[model samples]
Target: MWRCPLGLLLLLLLTGHVALGAQKGRGRRELAPGLHLRGIRDAGGRYCQEQDLCCRGRADDCALPYLGTICYCDLFCNRTVSDCCPDFWDFCLGVPPPFPPIQGCMHGGRIYPVLGTYWDNCNRWWQAGNHSAFWGMTLDEGIRYRLGTIRPSSSVMNMHEIYTVLNPGEVLPTAFEASEKWPNLIHEPLDQGNCAGSWAFSTAAVASDRVSIHSLGHMTPILSPQNLLSCNTHHQQGCRGGRLDGAWWFLRRRGVVSDHCYPFSGRERDKAGPAPPCMMHSRATGRGKRQATARCPNGHVNNNNIYQVTPAYRLGSNDTEIMKELMENGPVQALMEVHEDFFLYKGGIYSHTPVNLGRPERYRRHGTHSVKITGWGEETRPDGRKLKYWTAANSWGPAWGERGHFRIVRGVNECDIESFVLGVWGRVGMEDMGHH
Candidate 1:
C-alpha cells in the first residue's frame, strides 16, 4: 500500500499538495509516498518526467532515487542545494533552466557567476547575458527617466535652416574652450539628477555663460533651471521632458532668475510628479524689459532681478560655423540622440558604439538630449589618424565624464549633435552690468 510517513504527510499538507494520487494522467502510479511514476516519451535514461516526478511539496519522497544520491524534482530543491534533476525545470516548470550546464562566466582570468558584474575604472563590466547588472535598470527605463529633450518641433527645425552665416575667411584655431578663453564667465555644469529636465538645465547653462560673457563678467550669474522647469508651462512638461525651442522662448519672453534667487528644486519633487509651482514671476518694465515681481525664493539673497535672453539663432551644421559661433558667442546648445551606452561615458571622444546593438529592440533605446557645446579640438591617434571632437558640458554634474564635461566626435554630425546647434544673446543692458 502507498503510505506516507508522518513527517512527509505534514510537509505535503503544508505545501497544499497532499492528494497525490488524485491527479489522474498519463499512467500516474505512486511508487513511494510523494514519489510517483508518470509515463513519458523514452528519451534515454530515467529523468524527472520518466519517473513521473514533478514535486510541489517539500517531502523526502519528493525526490527519485538516482545513481548513489537522490535527485529532487521539488520546487524548493534548487534553493539551498543544487541536486535538481537534469530535466527538473523542463518537466516541472515547463520552462528552460536559468542557464546552460556550463554555469558561471570567465572574465579577467577569473570565473564569475552568470550575473556577476564589476567596475573597471569608470566603465562597468558585466558577465555576458547580464544586462541589468550594468545599469540597474533596463534600457527603456534609462531612456524614460534619464533623458528629457524632446525632438525639435517643425518651427525649431526650420530655425536651423535660417542659419547665421559666418565669415568663411575667419581663420579658426585648432581648439578653444569658452571657460579657458573667458575665465570665470562660463558656469560649470549642473547636475539634473534623475529628473528629465536637460532642456531647462542646458538652456540655463548656455544663458548663464552668454550673459556673463556679454556683460564682460560683470553679471556672471548662474541662472536657475527650476525657474524654467516650474514657470515655462507653455507646451512644456517640466521634469518629464521639454523642447529647446520652448525653453528658449521662455527665456526670451518670460525670463528666469539667478540660481541664488530661484535655485533648482526638480530634484526634491517626485521623479514622475508634476513640477512645483512657479515661485518667481515678472512684470513688464517698459521697452521690452522685465523685472521680478516677487522676492527671491531664497530669502538670504535680496536680488530677485529677472534675466532675459534675445531670440536664439541657429548655427549651420558645418563644424567651422559651430566653432565660430562658440568662439565669438559663449556656449551654444546642441541637441543629440543619447543612446543606452552614453550613460556609461567616462572620458574620451565619445561615439555611439554598436556593442549593445545586438540586444533586443527594447534594450537599444535612445532619446533626445540637449547639451552645451563649449569648444572643439582634434587629437592624433597612435595610428596617425587625427580624430576631431567637440568638448561639451553635460548636465549630469561634476562627478560625471571629465568633471561635468565630455568629448564627442566633432565632424560627420555624430549622434546628430551638429545637426541642430543654437546660440543666444543675453539681454544685458548697461544698467544690468552697473553692479560690477
Candidate 2:
C-alpha cells in the first residue's frame, strides 16, 4: 500500500469524526436557540417539549391540551379551553374522547345522560328542561331533593333486631307480586311532583295497600298523600320532607281522606311560591278556602272512611323475610340510600355501577329515599347473570321508570334499601271490620 503523510491521515480521521458529530446534532434541532429538542413522538407523529412551542405550524402537533409548551398528538383531551390551544384546536382538534359512549334516557321531558362524569351528566339533564330544569336543579340536586326527606338513618342494631325475629335462610317463593295477590287493591303509582314527599307518598301508598289487603279487597281507598304533605307537621315537615316513622304516626292518629278531596298541589305554586298553604278547612267562622270543616282536614266526610295505621315497626333486611312481609302484610316501606348513578336508572334490576367518581369515603350516601316494596323476583340478565330484585313503587310519576316503579337489586342491601325496612298494621275500625 502507498503510505501517505501521517499528518494528512490524522487530519482525515478528524474530519470524519467532525462530520459524524454534525449529523447527530442535526437529528435533534435546538428547541430554542440554545435548548435541545425534547424528542420525536411516533404515536401521532410529532415533537413535544415542556419549554418550547414545538407544535407551531404543524397539524399533528396540536392534538392535546395546551400545556403551555408541550405539544400533544393524542386523539383527544377534556376541554378546558383556558388550558388548550386557540379556537378549533381548543378541544383536541374536535376529536372525541376515548370514553364509553354516553348513554341517556328521557322521562317527563328530561333527558338524562346515563354515563360519563356525574357533573356533565347532570348538566346535560339540567339543560334538557322539565322536572330537573323546572326546579333549576342538577342531577345531584334533584336526587338530593328526593333523598333529603328521608330522616331515618341506617341502624345496624335495628337490622339485627329484625334478623333475630326472622329466619335469614328461609327460602322465599321464586316470585311474588303484591298487586297480583290483591288485584285492584294496589293503586297506580302516584306522582309526588317536584316535592320531596316520597316518604309520605310511600307511607300512604303502603297503608292503602294494607287496608285493601287486610279488608280482603272490600275497601280500596286511595288515601291522600297531600294530607301527609301539607298537614302532619309535628315530626314530619310538609314539602320539606318527613320520616317514615313520622308518616306512620300521622296516619295512625289523624287519617287522610281521598286524593279526590285534597289533591296534590305541592307542584301547584303561585308563581313558584310555596304550595297553596295546606288548603285547610276553616273552623274559625265564615267559609274559608278549604272544602269544609264538615270533614276531617284530610277531607273524609265519615270518620269511618278515615283509616289509621299502628305504630311502624322494623322488618328483616334479608330478601326472603322482606318477601314474606309483603306476602303477609301487603307492601312495606323501604328507606334507601341513593348514589349519584341512581338518577339515570330507567329499567332492569338497578345496581350501582362500578363507576364511582372517586367520591370521598366519608360521604357514605348522597341522599336517602323511601319506596314501597311491592314484590320480589329473580331475573336473568342478557349476559346470563342471575339478578334477584325487589319491585319498588316510586313517587316520581308514572312517566318515570317502568310506569313509576323500579326494580332494585335485592339481598345485597343494594343502595342500602334493606337497611331500614318498616311495616305496620292498619287498625280495623267497625266500618273496616264488617266490610271485608
Candidate 3:
C-alpha cells in the first residue's frame, strides 16, 4: 500500500482540494525542472495559472500537459527537489511563483532568450534569465585576458608628494584642455600595441607634454615609451607590466630618447613574449646629464638626444586641485580601474555601469590602468541633469574612443582615476632648444 508522510498529509488536509487526472498514465512522465507554460494566462491575466490545479493524496500520477511537457500538481512535487508545475504555488499553496516569468528580453527589435549574449566591436550586450539587460564582457574566451597597470604598492603611492594650494577667490573656468591651451605642443596619443606597459606609456606621454610646454614649444619631442619598456629593467617587467613610480624614477635618473630614436616595437600578437633587447644605451655626461651611446633604432633619424623629467609628484585627490594642476601645468597622469565594460567605451561621459553588479565573480573582473588627464568640462543632458567629465588620452591608439581620447565622469573619482594623480616638470635646458 502507498503511504504518505505525516507532513505531506497535513499539507493535503490544509489545501482541502486535489484534482486528480481521470486516467492513470501507463508510465511516469519526466519534465525539465522549473518548466512553465508560456503564452498561457489566467483570469487575472497572469501566465502561471487559470484556476485551481491540485492533486489527490500526494499522487505522482497527477500531471498536466504543458507545452509538450508534463508538470506535476502532486504534494510530493513540492519536496526539496521540486518539480512542481509553475502554477503549483498559486493553485496549491495560495502564493505567487518564487521566480520571475520565463520570458525573452526584447532588444534591437529582436527577442533574445534568457542569458543570450552577443558582441558588437568591443562591447558585449547580454540579457539575463530574469529578463534584465546588461552590458559587459560575458564568460567568453576574451575574459581570460587581463588588462594593464598593476595596482601601486604603498611605497610607490607615497613617493614624491606635491600639493597645489588654490588661490583665494581664483575661480577656475567651467572647462579646460591642455591641447587647446598649448596648441601643437601636447603630443597626440600613441598606441601601446599588445603590451601591458601603460605605466611606461602614460609616464612618457606626460613627460613629453611637460617638456614641450616647459621649453615654450621650442623642443616638442614625442618622448619614447619604448625607451622605458626596453631599458627600465631594474626590478621591472618590460611589456608585461611595471610600476609608475619606477618608470618615473627611470625617467628622472636614466632618462630616455625621442620616439623617433627608439621607436615602439610592441607587436600586436606578442604580449606575453619576451621584450626585445634594449637597442639604445646611454652614458652619464656629468653634472646630472646623460647622452645616448647608440644611434636611433629607426636608423633614418639621427636625433637620439635623451630627455628627462623632474621627480614625479603626487597630486591631492581633490578635483579642483587636479584641474588646477592640469590647467597651470600640462597633462597629468592618473591611475584608473579598468572594468571589463571599459573595453567597450565608445563615447559620452563614461561612468562605470551597475549592469554587472549581481553577476558572478568571474564576469566582474577588472585591472589597473593609467591615462593622461588633459582637461575637464560639464554637459547638460536633455533631461536637464548635469554631467561633469574629465577628458583623458588613452594609449590604445586613435582608432578607439573619441580619437584616442575619452571623457569619464569626474569629481566623484569614477573608477578611482582621481585617487593617484601625478605631475612632473621636464628637465629642459638651452641645449634642448638648440636642437630644434
- lDDT of candidate 2 at residue 165, scale 0 to 100: 40
Candidate 1 lDDT score relative to the true structure: 0.70
Best by lDDT: 1
TM-score of each: 0.70, 0.63, 0.68
Question: Lowest-scoring 10 consecutive residues by lDDT in candidate 1?
Answer: 35-44
Candidate 3: regions farther than 4 A off:
1-146, 269-273
Which candidate do you rate higher for TM-score, 1 or 2? 1
> Could you give candidate 3's per-residue lDDT for residues 1-436 as a string of tens digits?
0111222211111112245446454243343333333322111112224434577545655665433344567666666223566557666777654432222222332222232233222232221221111122132312222245678899877666677888989999999999899999998999886677888899999999999999999889899989998999987887777888889999999889999888898655344556788888888888678898989999899888888888888999999999999999999999998864555455556666534344345446667889999999997655566778899999877766677788988899999999999999998877777767
Off by over 4 Å in 1: 1-135, 160-169, 268-273
Compared to the true structure, candidate 1 yields what TM-score? 0.70
RMSD list, candidates in order? 14.8, 18.3, 14.2
Instruction: Give the alpha-carbon lDDT of every model.
Output: 0.70, 0.56, 0.69
Per-candidate clashes, comma-separated: 1, 0, 0
How do the residues 1-436 of candidate 1 rate in per-residue lDDT, one tens digit apiece? 0111222211111112223333322221322212111111111122577768887765556665432234567876655333566457666887644322211222332122222222223232221222221233444555666678999878769764445565667688988998899998988999887778999999999999998999988898899999998999888888889989899998999889899898887453344555589999999988788999899988899988788999998888888878888988889999999875566565667776443333335445689999999998987755567778999999888877778788988888989999888999999888877885
> Which prediction has the highest TM-score against the true structure?
1
lDDT tens digits, residues 1-436, model 2? 0111232211111111111111112112312421011211011111222222324333343443221233233333122222222222323354422221112222222222322212221111111112232233344446546553555645623434344344666666888998888888998888877677788788888898887777777777888888778877776767667877777877766666667667777553213555445543323222211123445444444442456667777887777777778887889888887664455455556666433233233222367788889998886645566768888998888766677788887889887888788887776655555663
Model 2 — which ten-residue stretch has the worst lDDT?
Answer: 35-44
